[model samples]
Target: MTSKPFNKFRIMMKSLMVCTALLGTTFLAKAQTWHFGPKFDANYSTMKGEGIKNKFSPGFQIGGFAEYNITKHLAIQPELLYSWNSYKKSDDFLTYYVNSGRSAAGNNVNLGTVSVPLLLRYNINNFLSVLAGPQYSYKIYDDEDLIKEGKEAFKNSEVSANFGFQVNLSNVGFYARFNKGLNNINDIDDRYEWKSSHIQVGIAVRIK
Candidate 1:
């Protein structure tokens, strides 16, 4: 049986897919103004909450992005990404888990997820632009650092706000973004709330 949170995440992803298809159909006539590219990124991410330490962990993302230019200065961009997000466990947390018989527990929380970010881009010049948007992430992999008694320790789906800027030089673009979870991700308890955040620095290569 699937977990309730996982089921809910699947539903949300399906809804997002339908909406994206409808939008694609509507904008097919203007496809000439669209651009597509592959993106690779390195990130430093950490989970923040009542009990966990905030030590950052290294991660990465591989993905593609599509953009529709609405004007010389404005565009809509959507990205599909597969990312590894990691957060380090604190000394105290590790000690507790070790005492509880989970002696082999890892020192970091490793999560693999697929994410979609719909952003509005504002170009200030040919080489620079600012972007902001909401990102949807659904977890597909977990290290289970927080799991206990067969119960999930985190929510399967997360909503985040992303803010950043990009620099373009011909077909190569470089960017940096900050992502912050907008909702509590702690599924195990009500006393200690959890939120995740990450910083990404990336390079994008246009293919179309």
Candidate 2:
């Protein structure tokens, strides 16, 4: 079970790296105005599905981004990030687990993933911008000590949509974004579909 997902994740990561390298190299060669930076985020995440009754769980991410200015008010931003997301199961969910002949270790699920986001940013002014984009993510690690595999757990890869706003002053930037998963992540006999969603708040500092 884990082997299949791990293989899929490796393939996806390789493909994404190729794409990122091409895009970044092209922009670096031709674009005169560019900003590259490190970013850190705090995320509040949850799952929505038939059996989920828990609230949001806190997580975080750290990574880097490159912003290429296409015009005075329009820019393209691409990011490579390592993200962590988590959730707590409801009492009903735990009961269901135990009733299914599986021992309930705990109620928490933690997932670590590598994500790539391609964003189109529209600058309203020098100080503000609005961004929207698509993101691809591949799972890297998971905490299965509690919520084991085959227990309505998530899959290897996910696609999501993001929309956000950014405030920038000099070399400092602050952003908040909402991400909604576009595909089902459930793997428990396919009886119910689960989708992940989160709110990410982060700070970015330009270094180049």
Candidate 3:
């Protein structure tokens, strides 16, 4: 009985060792072929007007993304981002001072929002890919120099659609994305419907 038990123990140990070796090999293969990374972004923004032309303005965004490989031809990317989107307008100094009782030449309105995007990427080659997805955004802050005037507060939430492309290098990637707001950035009683749109470019580094 003792001899039989010893033989069984020996067989179990060998099986365990083989399983461990296989698992280690699989882990190494996955590590060598795939990676995930963090991303950072900068943006140029402008409002899209239905009947008016709006000028382009400067903006920025920062974010991180997890990239997963399905094959040499495809991948999935999901990201969480904080973006600043705004436009600027100049006012006459004498008119502004006389009307608003504030001694200022010109003023600017700045709007800030946070967004999350999930994208599906189709790789055209090792160097290029195209991405498209839906983005959800919330307005966190908006500052206006003429708020002391009778202007109401700015809107607070936004929903948008996102589309873009990615360029991949040895251990880094670059991307450009465009976002269009689906909802108004202002309330119903506001004079104009504040439509938001932006273009973002970013760099990414692979860590895993």
Candidate 4:
């Protein structure tokens, strides 16, 4: 009779141990599912022209992004980024100097901007996500040599909207974003416009 009671006790203890082990495994898997990390980006920027040949100007960014999983299909991402943008003047000045009565000056301008973007991300699957959001940018520095003569300053601050898509791996993600400027970049003259629309490719790591 004592042996029968002891055997029942043993069975109960073994079941409890299995339950505890399963719970621990579930917690570990949940912890590994969420993460945050730093990012680096490289991009190209150029002006839109009609009947003008445009060249790609190189740009880059470094930043950090955080992601929270709301479900298997939805997420929220916010990022703080430092971005550099470059633009070049048209060759019309060269044509003016050769054919018309003017001197040609080549102007290649670069602007440094600090940007913060809040994006809403929708996951199509484990490997792909689409993002769109508003971005605010403050001018940190500008190349004076690139500005036209008599201009006090180029456009310095901007607010814009961005849209992009991301490709995600287990712990790493690659993304491409396009920013469309809604504010004038030049603060000196209203007639002189400084706007930006560029495509950036970046890598992200998950920390959590």
Clashes (backbone N, CA, C under 3 Å), per candidate, total 0, 0, 1, 5
* Residue 197, model 2, lDDT: 93
Ranking by lDDT: 2, 1, 4, 3
Question: What TM-score would every model get versus the actual structure?
Answer: 0.80, 0.80, 0.68, 0.70
Q: Write the per-residue lDDT of candidate 4 for residues 97-179, one digit (tens) a residue.
A: 23321243336656666677888999999889999999998766555342245343455668989999999898899999898
Q: Output the lDDT of residue 38, model 1.
A: 73
Worst 10 residues of 3 by lDDT: 92-101
Selected candidate, larger TM-score, 2 vs 3 = 2
lDDT of 3 at 38: 55
lDDT value for model 3: 0.64
Which pairs of residues clash in candidate 3, taking residues 3 or more apart in a chain or in different chains? 35-208
lDDT, residue 64, candidate 1 = 73
Candidate No. with top lDDT: 2
Report how far residue 20 has shifted in candidate 4, in Å: 39
Model 1: ten consecutive residues of lowest lDDT? 94-103
RMSD per candidate (Å) reads 5.6, 4.9, 18.2, 20.5
Residue 142 CA displacement from its true place in model 1, Å: 0.6
- Show the lowest summed lDDT stretch of 10 residues, model 4: 96-105
Score each candidate by Cα lDDT. 0.77, 0.78, 0.64, 0.67
lDDT for predicted candidate 2 compared with the true structure? 0.78
